[model samples]
Target chain A: MEMSAHNCRLVFVVLAVSGCAPPDSTSEEQLRPVVPGGFDSVPVPVHNPLTRNKVLLGQQLFFDPILSLDSTVSCATCHRPDAFFADGKAVSRGVGGRPGTRNTPSLLNIAYHQLFFWDGGSITLEHQVFGPLQNPAEMALDLASVLQRLESIPTYREAFEELFDEAPSLRGLTQALGAYQRTLLSGGARYDRYKAGDQTALSPAETRGYKLFKGKAGCLHCHHGFLLTSLRFENNGIAISKEDSGRARVTGLKEDYGKFKVPSLRNVAQTAPYMHNGGMATLSEVIDHYDQGGREVRGKSPLIQPLGLKEEEQADLEAFLHALTDTTVLAGIEGP
Target chain B: MNYRNNIFIAVNLMVLFLVGCDAATSDTGSTTLTLNLNAQVNGKPLSTDPGTTFDVNGTLISFESVRMYISEITLINSNGDPVSILGDGLTVPAKNEDDEDISHTVQDHIVLVKQDAGIDSYDLGTWPAGKYEKIHFKIGIAGTNNRIDPSQVPAGHPLAKQTDYNNHWNWNAGYLYLRIDGKVDTDGDAVPDDEWAVHLGTERFLRQVMVTHDLILEADQPGILDLSIDYGEFLRNVDLSDPDQRICHTMNNLPVANAVANQISSAFSISTDRKRTGGSTSADG
Candidate 1:
């Protein structure tokens, strides 16, 4: 009954080749996401496959504050669905009103991401779930305490047993949360529609901005592909502080200082306060930072150089970023 | 009458042969053994209590916590052949939910040794009852096991997220081999003013230790392999006065980490007498 990773990958490919949805669909109703044309299939870990019951349980746990030490803040406290799963703040507030160090990132289309966190500390979503749960600045509860809290809830105990065939455990809790987050896919934007042969999907200014994003603006250097990110670490010349060395904190390499994950531009219009520290207040500020060839910092990427972009070009680029937003991504999932 | 007598003799011989086979099976059966790790400082028993302080190089130092991961354990027989001791199979979740069994060989069974957490002893799985010439074990986890997803492991597992203490680095870096935190008195006030933390990790720092001893395991009589870890030897040549040299997180400073890693193999010695296995013989601290 157990499937090997090779066989699971083979099944994923076969499902993709055929017109049918993948077997690891989070909903009983096939995901049937209208992804951007040429968007690759979502990469699911072979160990934790998505299921309807598991996703439902994960979704319920995601909003439940019981995971926190004080039972006040949940994963949804910082990752709000209305703000494209990212709280519209420079830094998120956690349990006991402790201030988070970095900006809260959007979980929308997180399935396509290869790494998690601003520093890319965790490779898998399952492992990433523990970072916030244990960080004193975040939900602020140890894994032992979180498991014990879940064990007390009858509905949680029964749901975990039904889905994972075990008591409330680290594997079940993380896998369920990961499955639910994977279901928050967003690809039915006007940009995707236009790419899918819809002529009236974009306005003239937005279409011009799209051209600049690939051409003069040179945004595609790091933010390439349908996911709008290379999913690699780069030191985009944000002013570095002694406290936060960015990727170097995890990698322990001098060359990796100030480097952080290049975030996806999907739903950029909704999730304001850009950059790892949320230094930029608006999309205009973000474009200006890029046009000015980023900040002068140690280990800054060599690709960044002054663009000398006209006033109207920046506006057009912002319009194109707006077109990438898909309001219907949160249609089925209820509010927290 | 002569044919009936011969047939009865043959049937009696068959019964005797079956009884002999059962006797041999019972003698060679596996018995679960226990491994007791006793911490000592300068030939004296060491305790994890906050009030317990030891005189080290004319300075008083007290250990706050001592934890480590021991893996790849094996027993060498008299013939020089190695027998794996902890490979019964770890239970992990299957790739598919419909899978009947959860058993998988993710890695060699590893044990966490933490005196403060009251986990100084480990129940080594059943091994063939016999004499083992030497006990071989690695100080840290290795390969895929070190980098296994933390969330996927079962609760209460050494590498699981729900472990009692945090021994893990970020996802890619893996678990620490050994973590020893303590405070030392630099000014000789005996108040232990300075804090010191020595953490060694990564595959590069994995050190294999072998103790040559006559470890006997008897059928139905579980054997105990008692070991004494000298805290004095572990902190030898490490300067506790300088704040810079006092700490090693295993990555930032290579020299400090290297010094700590090199001393680990020498810090451990097999106790001839089962001092901790039987009862407290030395100071119970």
Candidate 2:
């Protein structure tokens, strides 16, 4: 608990000192920018600078519901802890029974995320934050009115006063939420431990799955790196066009017509209803989608080729993917 | 709150002050040279285009947004003998459209913007610095390349809609060096009906090297140098029409890569006729 607070403070320091640092790389990973109080993906928007006070302040706003229309739902409502900050329902219920087009992606390691939406439209975590807060289907509150709502609450007003010395402002609200979001970094998984040099961490099946994923399975093509995602957009060889325009809407390029930003499988087993349109409900089905080269979308990414994985290999890969499960970040995140 | 902390703060401030003073005094006696860069893109000046150009062919051309970039201006003192111009080169904008409608022109419109025509001018505090002689430059990527995953390049630069460019290669994690397109008569039909677009880039043949030479300038003489890029030669020399010799844009192509690499490098001949690098880049690439 205390560790997260320190990480939050470190995040603030990174934001404040962003312009001075290089973008997302380190001379050595150990020498990363200290923020909220530990190291993770370099604190995003180093220009915004996170303060322990700011993150603590942001968390209060995240759960306060004061920023919502009816004051009934906070960002944490659908994004609860027990489910990796993602509501496990095929589609999460938003403010006043509003249903969002895409499933609630797990906010785990979101600070390390490059593009925000499944279609890769919202380019930054900060930019995407506004969508949920203002979407009539989501929190159902306008940003312009959020400041007024915060000021109405003495708790929010006093909290802002103690953290910023000034009353609540739009910038303050954003900075606070941004700060709080950065602390939602969830790692310490089997893969992280293995990469950090605990060779014995993975079980036998998981080890084979990891090997297959990196080699023949080609899962690593989109799901690459320590962040577990190359963060690229692809058609995923599934029929994703019926629902969303996919990445095509963001980039009007015909080639990207059915593409969508590949979601990180950090806690994949938990966040079900896969694909940008939530067409695949199980991991096995998703692997099956890749086994057959994506349906003939006019502009499918050339990378989406048929893998032809055997039944056992596919099952083993799923087992290995399950090792990515991280229960800590989703449980009891909000507390004193 | 502690006395020692206060003393540390004072020491730090003193150090910063000393560094600032040293920086100010060390460099001196150079004239400020400013070049007003004017680029007339696609036969029409920047003032003309409704801010977008239409391309007829290529590997899924998403004209949603685009930008272009060219830096490292080596001003040549074409006066007497060959003298290389040097000093500070300021890349004013931070890489996108939000900075201005101009920076994007540097990143996109590769088919249009030029060093002098599209790139405009340069000012080195005053006049040209160093032994100004013949100038040389590469029309592409510089070192301090944005090392981070390019995912945020869109947010950093919302103006050009750069987030939409899928010219990147999935095989390797890098952006396509260049994308060139135009109708090609593979069978030599009089009409350009047999359409083909060249997709170039990736780690292999990223060498679309464009260079300049023999630039002349005297104190009293006119010093505007223009480079002519004969697109005709680009098509012929690069063999844009030959299907066997030319690489097709079927997700990947190499001969087309080699051809563009060879032609664009040799096609850009420096001439003294116009002020900038040649005919305005046809914004529709």
Candidate 3:
């Protein structure tokens, strides 16, 4: 069969055990399977092409704290590669050590997401970049000020001109950061190998646990796609807080209260302190919360029903979830 | 004598040809219309500069800023035919790379009335010279335009991210149609202390305001349609002294947002002022 470059890359990812080369040493062409799977159709916005130079510039900008007002926190501070792109914190701290309202979500496989943030407030990946940079509790830097700062730096200014054929601008900043994040693809979990025709890839308990997750646990209702997210806003019965009304803040509908975007389950094991508010600390606790059908709240989804699983079954389910982790992403980690 | 007479006759014929029948009669030519917004507080001239205090329900309130979105403006003629004011064809950035050709008219024909920025007069463009019965305009942004992607738009455009003093809400995916930021004196001290921001928006809060006038436009003449908005009338029922009634961002404080939205139309009055003859209408506050 004639295969497109993207389809060929997907096949290559599945066939090769070590699908993606490490981030630091990999060349531009070798960056194809940054995420391994059959997700050939990555939703990269056409306006911002995923060029190698742009991605490199974006990578530097992502780690640079100059975007913040205090120059102390970077995008990498909250979304750490060591922790599967999610900070292992209940709520992320920003400039001046101000606590954010929502948990820092993982950036792994973010290209697959249609909407951004817990409330699905931002429609485009480019649209989402302005929030944290200007949010007073976060970076605390205005767009005009940030542009001036970036413009003063010869390196950023030269790079922006070469890549975008323009001066350092709002478009250049958003597009660059977005391009770099689209490359943070995660795949090649043991579960992926099992799905790729290796029957013995999963242990007997993991296999049984996967069945329960799809069947009795009813996780497949929202977490079913290859990226393991329906990519839709849903009310999973998280306790409603008036200070943060979740999706209702965006849609302005009372019926949308307590709703949040169902995040992808890829690299779930590493991205600890789960849920929108980081209310749950562990995967087992998360599973337990779901097992009990979550907190009783207004506008809670009916899909969340009590799963009557035993202790052993719950343990197996947690083990199965661990199988979803991309071990290569955690290859060189030494400490907690 | 005959040659001089022939030259005079030729000159007269040339003037008739160059001027055209329409221009000669002064009945079919067009004129540019300018809309001037005059802001006031209880019949006095209003100033949005900080420390410019005004009386609102016996409380001294100083406005930090006052801005609103005006869109879908139409002028009703003597025959009651509506004339749409075509804007200068301004645009924001494209949402997609391929959509470069698409005119981002979501903000076109719309004016951001920012009194603090000293931008109050808007050129409504040239129109056929005649009389109009009334003027019509909406006080807030309409659907689709409110939800425009501000990221795509360049700075300085009316609907750009930074234009309305950061009026767009990053968390709500919509712009604040009308934003009023001020400080109120709660304890009877003349100096203002408590800061208040009344951000009115969301599709449900849109209000349409119409002003009746007997305006006449002369051929090739610039006309000014003077409009006045009273801060006293706008804060009619809302007691700014009450701590709970001071602030609103639409959804968070629905009561204050509703009160402001309900009082929008009554705040505005128009002056059918003829710039050529310098005449004023009775409603001119």
Query: lDDT tens string, model 2, B1-285?
Result: 699999999999999877645322222233443334333222223321223332212211112112223334444443433323433222211223121111112232122132322344433223322234344444344432311223223223312113123343322223444444434444433334444555554334433333434332323323454544433333444444345644444234455555655654554454334544333322111
Model 1 residue runs over 4 Å out of place are A1-38, A330-336, B1-31, B57-59, B91-104, B128-131, B170-172, B182-196, B216-221, B245-248, B252-255, B275-285
The candidates, ranked best first by DockQ, are 3, 1, 2
* Candidate 3 per-residue C-alpha lDDT over A1-336 given as tens digits, one digit per residue, 9 for 90 to 100: 111112111111221123444332223332332446566556555455566667767777887788899988778788876677788998988999999998999998887776689997876677788898888878888888888999999988998888767788777788788877787777779999999989998998899889988999999999987989987889998887779888888877888888998998888888889899998989999999899998898888999989999998998899889889887765533331
Predictions: Cα RMSD each: 8.1, 15.1, 8.1
Q: How much is the TM-score of the A chain of model 1?
A: 0.89
TM-scores for every candidate against the unseen true structure? 0.82, 0.51, 0.85
Candidate 2 lDDT (Cα, 0 to 1): 0.53
Q: Each candidate: how many clashes?
A: 2, 54, 0
**How do the residues A232-294 of candidate 1 rate in per-residue lDDT, one tens digit apiece?**
889997898888888887767899999999999988999989999988999999999999999
Ranking by TM-score: 3, 1, 2
Question: Model 3, range B1-285, lDDT digits (tens) per residue?
Answer: 999999999999999777664321234677988878878888777887776889887888988778888888877777788777576664433333221222255634777788877777987777777777677788777765665577766555667677237777877777778988888888887888889888888879988887777678888778778877876777778889888889888888888888888888878876433233333333311
Candidate 3: residue pairs that collide: none
Q: Which TM-score value belongs to model 3?
A: 0.85
DockQ of each: 0.28, 0.02, 0.30
Candidate with the larger DockQ of 1 and 3: 3
**Residue A141 of model 1, lDDT score:** 90
